[model samples]
Target: MILEVATITLRSGNADEYVRVMPDAFPVLASTPGYIRHELHRGIERPDVFTLFVWWESVEAHNVNFRESDRFPRWRAVWGHLMEGAYVEHFAQVY
Candidate 1:
């Protein structure tokens, strides 16, 4: 399996709005092929920071299957504007 980790920073005072609108993007994400599950976590020390964890069957499931699909834009439209910046990376269990 592949694990996608996205560290996202929101614009000032946008954290509440971002969390409120997150559910609107779930359907779009869940419908994607190879999508397993996901989680969103807020940083305690930095209220404006969030971390998104997504599990997929493989890297291609996200990079190609999802990102290349029409759902990408739809998903982004949900909260993209709320983000000041984001960094994404994929990982696999070493053991």
Candidate 2:
């Protein structure tokens, strides 16, 4: 399995809007091939900071199946404007 971690920082006063709009993309993401699951976390001390943990069958599954598909743009269109900065990376279980 592959894990995609995305660290996101929201623009000032955009936290509430971000949270509201975030779940809107779940259906799109869930429909993606090879998309296993995902979790969204917010920093306690810094509410504007969030990290999205996504599980996929593989990196290609994430990229080709989701990011390369219409879902990617659908997702970005909803939240891109709210982001102050964001970064994404992939990971694997150590075992």
Candidate 3:
């Protein structure tokens, strides 16, 4: 399995709106093939920052099944506006 982490920073005063809209956007991930699970974490010191951890069967499962699919656009349309900057990276277990 692979872990996909998205580091997102929202514009000032946008955090509440972003949280309100998140549930509606989650179904897109739930519908994706190879999607295992996800967790949303907010920064303790920096409220504007969020880290989303998503588990998938593989990197290809994420890149091909979700990122390349219609779900991506739909998901982006909902949350994209809230983000000031974001970056994604994939990781694997060491042991």
Candidate 4:
């Protein structure tokens, strides 16, 4: 399985609103091929920091199949206003 994590740092005071927006946008991503799961996590110690975990069966499944699809545009619009910046990482489960 391939895991993609996007660490999002909201522009202060917007974190709670940011978290609330995700589930509503999920249907756009969930319908894509090879999308195994989607999860969002917030930092307890750091606060206002979030990690969006996306489980895909393969990189190509995301890069090739999903990105070019129609859903990403609507997905982008969902939280486009609340974001500051994000860092993304692709990882494989080693444990």
* Model 1 per-residue lDDT tens digits across residues 35-74: 9999999999999999999999999999998999999999
Provide TM-scores for the models.
0.97, 0.95, 0.97, 0.89
1-95, model 3: which lDDT tens digit per residue?
99999999999999989999999999999899999999999998999999999999999999999999999999999989989999999999999
| Residue-wise C-alpha lDDT for candidate 4, range 34-75, written one tens digit per residue | 999989889998678888999999988787777788877888
Candidate 1 lDDT at 48 equals 100
Ranking of models by lDDT:
1, 3, 2, 4
Model 2 Cα shift for residue 71 (angstroms): 1.0
Model 1 collision count: 0
| Runs with alpha carbons beyond 4 Å of true place in candidate 2 | none
Measured with C-alpha atoms, the lDDT of residue 63 in candidate 4 is 78
Tens digits of per-residue lDDT for model 2, 48-73: 99999999999999999999999999
Query: For every candidate structure, what is the RMSD over all alpha carbons to the true structure, in angstroms?
Result: 0.7, 0.9, 0.7, 1.3
Number of colliding residue pairs in model 2: 0
CA lDDT, candidate 1, residue 11? 96
Ordered list by TM-score, greatest first:
1, 3, 2, 4
Candidate that beats the other on TM-score, 2 or 4, i.e. the better one: 2
1 versus 4: better TM-score goes to: 1
Q: Report the C-alpha displacement of residue 57, candidate 1, in angstroms.
A: 0.2
